[model samples]
Target: MLKTMHRPFHVSPWHLTLACGLFKLLLAAAAFALPLSQVDDLPRLVGLLLLAGGFSELLLSWTGRHSWVGRITFGSGALTVVLGALFIGGPWKGLYPLGPFVTVWFLLRALLSIDVAFQSRLTPMANWIWLLLRGFVDLALGLLLLAGAPLAMLAIVVFGEVREFVTLFSATLAVSFAIAGGGLVAIALTQRHYHRSDPFMIAS
Candidate 1:
């Protein structure tokens, strides 16, 4: 089992930042590729994904913590799950824009990942590179979301004419949920691997 501590291998914050950025980029790509219409539907999908990813992190935290790095990872993962659940529950009526919220979430995750990467002391060079790429992608996506608000609105208006567009939008949302759910499941499996090194721990 991982024991929580104040320090581990003397990893850096930039690594964690990179990891966080990469995760965000992956999420943005997954979301952007969908045929989603309104931003409201995004939270449900994102929340589900977070729930899965957090579960994984929780497991990793339990197993890898012989140091401060473990503590941070577990804490962050727990927080993510909690926040994700709140988002999934749909607290208010259109309280937040799905697009912006998702974009911000990804950006934050990317930052967190960078921190993780630096602190963990695990290296392959590729991991760091991946994280950097992810961060840049997430940042770009966030900027696009911010800049494309009017354009998104315009798309909504343009698609208001045909039922096919609405149908496609609904299908897109359904696919998003599936993909997010799958991602969560994958994360959970990863956590299980870290926890017991058992291939079967991921059956859920």
Candidate 2:
């Protein structure tokens, strides 16, 4: 009397990726919605929020598409997670946190642009130049933050140094979250379509 074994359900990568993307977007919303700025330990509170965002990013990386695109995505996510951990442990407080956070965001975004480029290649006559250009720009921004000179100048021009550059940093985070979230969802949909068409493609 042999018993049949039941296999546990496995989540599709696209599903998990979209969920993580949505969660990341929500983290940005939470960061903005909460009035933690007025509190005494802004760094600790903000650090916690960033930690949550980082965790989602790590999860996204884990569930992202399986390819070189995914590898770069994972590296980007891991780097941001490390920065969040550093912020929580000590240092990376106040204005110092902004640079690393923004830089990491741009770097992650650049990797995502690579993913977009990879996807575009599958389409006919795809204008991958746009995606590559965006990736270059994002990479430049991250490098500039490391340079410290240009980022400061850009920050001053965009949001000014007043009010601790809070507006500037938050805006950066917001844009990163928004773009990544939307892109991940769109990519997930595309992947789903591809999966659905696989059998037909094979038969053809």
Candidate 3:
């Protein structure tokens, strides 16, 4: 007689969804709290954040063996880090505008996310919706930054309190990154759990 074994219950998709939702909400709230005048710095801040995020993501992807996420995430992170480094390291070139670069990055990220959504198993419709929304936000923010309208208005409203604006902006960005990083780590842990499961059982 063959023996059957039971697998341990792992974190469900719903849990991941909730965690991602909370992380996004925190990021949104942080953005809202940023002073209007500091908006111009968004591009630089985003570049720095991307650099850090990309490195972390690469580490996670390389260490985990779940499906396409590891490879895709690793590739995406490496690209982001390289591009971000170039943008920040290079001298200011009018043609290489932060807005356009950010826009392209977001679009690419969104398209890549389609793979993430379908990998391993089919992602829920709601997850696809979330990815689309994130893409939209990235596109909109990039456009806004390029147009220079919001930043101008913010500067006028704040009357040029440059130091305070910079400080607040930096703080908000730090918080956003913290939340995002934490969420990614959590999801990675969950994936590791699943990957480590026994090959004989579905939960494994």
Give the top-scoring candidate (lDDT): 2
Residue 86 alpha-carbon offset, candidate 2, angstroms: 1.3
| Candidate 3: tens digits of C-alpha lDDT, residues 113-171 | 55454442332121334334444444444454456535644774667434454444335
Global CA lDDT of candidate 2, please?
Answer: 0.57
Tens-place lDDT per residue, model 1, 1-204, is 543333332222333323443454465455444345354555566566668657755665565465564576677677668767876886633323454565565457556556755543342221334334444554554565567556665665676324343343334333333333343334444433344221111111
Point out where model 1 deviates above 4 Å. 1-43, 91-96, 118-126, 157-204
The worst-scoring run of ten residues by lDDT in candidate 2 lies at 195-204
TM-score of each: 0.49, 0.64, 0.50
Query: Candidate 2, after superposition: displacement of residue 37 in Å?
Result: 1.4
What's the lDDT for all of these models?
0.48, 0.57, 0.48
Question: What value of lDDT does candidate 1 attain over all alpha carbons?
Answer: 0.48
| Candidate 2 positional error at 33, Å | 4.1
Please report how far candidate 2 places residue 87 from its true position, in Å.
1.2
| Tens-digit per-residue lDDT, 111-189, candidate 2 | 7776667655534222345456657667766775678646666765786554445554555555556656665566556
Model 3 earns a TM-score of 0.50
The better-scoring model by TM-score among 2 and 3 is 2
